[model samples]
Target: MTAPTLRGAAAFVQQVRAAEQHLSGADPVMAAVIERHGPCTLGATRRDPFHTLCASIISQQLSSKAADTIQARLMAGIGAGRRITPPLLLAASHEELRGYGLSTAKARWLRALGEAAAAGTLDFRALGRLDDEAAIAVLDALPGIGRWTAEMFLMFALNRIDLFAMDDVGLRRGVAMLYNRGRPLSDARTLKITRRWAPYRTIASWYLWRVADPVNEIWV
Candidate 1:
């Protein structure tokens, strides 16, 4: 499926609202969560899933500031964002990426992503066709990509409504605090409780992340 345009996305929002209503009727948890959290922001993106996924991998395990800096360096390395193709990424030496502040593992993982894309093993165009689980399975097959990464891909790149990154520490912590629990929410427990949110789990997860941001003193 082609990426959603701004107009198309508005339509999708309407569709989601309808789905939310239906799902809410079936499951009150979903209705309540949607009422609290509203819509999940699917940012406007001209880039395809390939670029989005590549960016996400580059951002992994790094602070947002560090990720932005590395991304800028890599963009400079490629000369222009337009040249950030699979071959260019594959051709970029490990030393080159390291020079741009990438760890050895991150460079290797990026190369794997490039190689998979080049080999037709990672098809950005076909990503929309796959169900959430299948899409995640395909992504996790790559090096350096874990469930969190796959879940991020589903939530952001795929604009999947039902997906949530349960393994995210920030989300777990946020949810734990939200419900006024003394212990942090375990992944298994998060899954069980999240059943109520159903199709809007991603939106709920976003709020949870915001609520957990230490710099903002949200949890306090």
Candidate 2:
């Protein structure tokens, strides 16, 4: 697959700088974040869609380091230095997968994903062709997947250019700090504030993640 670019990031900053000079509700906090962080971009791993989705599941609510460790263990068990395949995962029993450090829920989710892939129900190729809404709808139809998981699939796996996670705690907290607020910003409020960004919200979202998570900035 061709690599995605952050051309949107640079353009959004230019637009924001121009808009803030005239607009009343432009996020000055976001402006300051761009100024401090320089230009941000999509830093997604170059993995296949299925693997990326699996990685996203592993990452849910876990620290990045912990997720990586668990994923490494699972992968090593599934395929010895080979690609992650549905057949390989299905070959392992539930207890075997759980022994690799997956919670009961995550192990079930992984099994369902593998079953879907094997049955041709979860078409990664078709998912690649889907727009943001369609992709989310398809993924979230599965058990154990929700809106946040679907959004992560869009942002990281499909590399959708126009998406953002309003519910992201890091982004909200970062926005609060950048704006000199004492409390975390609410998702509803953040969504309202991000309107000026429009189609470039994904780029803005990247900046928020970076600002909100400095220790993990290396990943951004």
Candidate 3:
């Protein structure tokens, strides 16, 4: 199936409100979170999939500020006249990429992703035509892309409405706080609890992340 049609901000806000209403009816615990958090700011920011994936790789095990610093350096190194295309990335040397603060493993992964793009093995344009599971599978097949990273692509890039990153520490913590009385939920329990939020779980996940760490901005 093709991806869901992208909506403008106004339309998306209305959609989120509707989802919240549905969630409130389905789960009282989550309802209280919505009530307390007021409105969610889970708007999608469209990005080139390749670049976004590369950014995801760059962000692994790093803080948001550090990731931002590395990404800025990478963009500068790629130069102003050129776009951050797969070919440009493929042409960049390990030394150059490492200079931008990329670890050897990450630099290798980025290059491999670039090669896949150049060879048409990973087509960004066709991603929207895939179902969520298929899209996640495709992304997860990449060298450095894991299930969590792929789920993130679905949430932030394709704006998929139903995905839940069950392994995410923050989401688990938030679930524990809201439902388990401030103790972290086991992965199995988290999965079962999140089932009720289906179709709007992405929105629910956003709120959970917020509740887990209200002070820190989650960039990944």
Candidate 4:
């Protein structure tokens, strides 16, 4: 398959610069993180909504390696292609999907997602036009999708720049390390701290994720 074009090249760089400046000035802890991490290189990999959401489901609660294994099996089961569309996923049986290493519940969720896509109940095209809240609502309304997952879709799929996923464990842990001196902060406190990130919280969140796992490569 042709390589997917990188989304929002000039705009993403500008946002990264703006976010780094704001974050560095607003909080010394974040400023240090910025200094260490240098320029934010996070950018959305071009993916259709269906495959992105499906991949998110596959990734839930699994280590990156494990998730990649399951996803590879799933793709091989469906067909030998980088893209996994709703029609292709729907063509597979539940047992077949389960054999691809998905838990039964996740297999069901994938099927439900496929059905929704097939029926036009979840309009991929329309989602791009909706604002963050509305788009999140649409994603969260699907079976097995939650706020975190929806927010991930926003950051990694839609490339929305302002999202701060308050419930992300890595973000919270990173915040604690950077701001709270290695103590986990309450969700309320986390949100309060992240408020300064504003308009560029997604970029900040990427740095925090990096802080949380310095050895692991972060994928968006």
Clashes of each: 0, 0, 0, 0
Model 1 lDDT per residue over 89-109, tens place: 877898998888888998898
Tens-digit lDDT string for candidate 3 (1-220)? 2223454656776877889998999999989999998877766444567777888889999988899789888878877232367877877898899999999999999999999999999987788789888999999999999999999887876667788888788888888888889986777888899999987999999899888888876533
Question: lDDT of candidate 2?
Answer: 0.71
Candidate 1 regions off by >4 Å? 5-7, 16-39, 214-220
- Return whichever of 2 and 3 wins on TM-score: 3
| lDDT minimum window of 10 residues, candidate 2 | 16-25
Candidate 4, residues 1-220, lDDT tens digits: the string is: 1112454566666766888898899888889988998787766356577888998999999998999999999999899498788888999999999999999999999999999999999987788889899999999999989999999888887777889988888888899998889998888888889898887888899999989998877454
lDDT score for candidate 3 against the true structure: 0.82
Full-model lDDT, candidate 1:
0.71
lDDT of 4 at 216: 78
Report the lDDT tens digits of candidate 2 across residue range 1-220.
1223477445544654444332223665666767777655464344466776777777788998899899899999887364567888899999999999999999999899989999999988777777788888999998778888888767655556567776677767766776546476666776777777666666677777776777684334
Which is the leading candidate under TM-score? 4
The TM-score that candidate 3 achieves is 0.88
Question: lDDT of model 2 at residue 118?
Answer: 92
- Model 2 misplaced stretches (Cα beyond 4 Å): 1-28, 80-83, 217-219
Candidate 4: residue 182 Cα off by (Å): 1.2
lDDT of each: 0.71, 0.71, 0.82, 0.85
Give the 10-residue window scoring lowest on summed lDDT in candidate 3: 1-10
